[model samples]
Target: MPPSPVVPCHSPVPDPSLYEPINTLKPVVPDVWIADGPVVRMAMPCGLSMPFTTRMTIVRLRDGGLWCHSPIAPDDALFAAIDALGPVRDLVSPNQLHYAHIAAWKRRYPHAVARASPGVSERAAAQDIEARFDAAFDDAAPSPWPGEIDPLLFRGSRAFGEVVFFHRASATLVLADLIENFEKEKLTRGMRAVARLGGVLDPDGKAPLDMRMTFTDRGAARDCLRQLLAWKPQRVLLAHGRWYERDGVEQLQRAFRWLE
Candidate 1:
């Protein structure tokens, strides 16, 4: 009999052997004080079809409950560490492609109100991810951490639209899927080829070409970038790869170099 064709799935399907639920290799980053409060950074080994590491951010709201953004996969050690900070009251998925771990966090923090990025609910519905988005974020910042975190929604893309955030206190911009900064030495041989072809490897990493091409409204993206620049970020945090500890504004300008 002739071999049947392999149907490709554009979804988060964790390859059991390569996937690590929690970031077991590194220690949780210490908290950094932002404009209105402090935020903690956590990491995990993620990726379904391929393998890569990702990060999440946790901020304490005025009500003393934690607000988690783009949550990472959970494990016992990570859970204990998160518990030490405070009660987790809010969980968030910053982009459609970032909701894989939100369900895990929700399971652990049932009291937490989970917010999904625009179109994430639909994405979750199609995938095996058990996520119920309590609400969705738009270009405007939400009330939970109002006046401190500014959210910018980049529309006109069905591939994976993302809502970027700028934290006023620390002058730090947070992103998911929009920018990936991977060092040449860090990637596997296969990923190295992928990163090279996508033009997102090493010191000058930006969004992949596939993602950039999906952006139908560069005008909207440009305006959004302008809004973010007004914040004058000093650092940038990324979910996919290394973050910028300095020259954040310059990094943004470079990351969006294709816009102009």
Candidate 2:
């Protein structure tokens, strides 16, 4: 008889390992802010769970309307803090996997338009996740913040599509999962192993190996990358791991080097 497979036993990382001051606004630039939230255990290959630290980006438009990207789990204090910033006008899901919390945010801000990324609505419905969207993101930026924030669909991956944003005022590029830079100190031994294997650890983070492989059409992805670089972002904000505060273009180039 064949020997039983040996499964690794690893404890989940403590919540404190996540970004501090959870669910509160941390200023990234004059009009842009980021909020870190509780850890979400995402299923990994081999029957493992990878603890992902959730993050969300908020941009205050010139009209005093707040634009939220990849909103995390909602709480009263977080909502109150968001209200203080301005009226919630746009709640966005940057990618299909990031739409789980949009329903909660919609309940809190009924008037706010819940914008869905490509295939997000279908993904949610298949997962039986209750979420509604007033409109879907396209190659061009939508109204209310047209020139303020530019949106681009980073295509090529048939599995999922992510809408990346470039905030002109702050020169900040907002991303959901194109690049994940997990800090080693904040991870459990098991998670660190996984992050290392997935190529998502900080200082050399890029798209996870699995995700990079999905880009069968590198040409289309390259076209998207060119547009993002054209923006010449000064700062790069990501939904997971430590974000790049400077040299946005360089960081982007490094993260997506696989394309070349």
Candidate that would win on lDDT: 2
Off by over 4 Å in 1: 1-49, 140-142
Best-matching candidate per TM-score: 2
Residue lDDT tens for model 1, 1-260: 98999999997765332323334323223343211111223232223134455677766655667767777766777778678778988787888877777877888888788887888888788876689767777555455577766777866565777877776766778887788876666566876777767767767788877788888887877887888888899988777656788998899898889889
Model 2 stretches with alpha carbons more than 4 Å out = 1-15, 140-144
Worst 10 residues of 2 by lDDT: 137-146
TM-score of each: 0.79, 0.92
RMSD of 2: 8.6
lDDT for every model? Answer: 0.70, 0.91
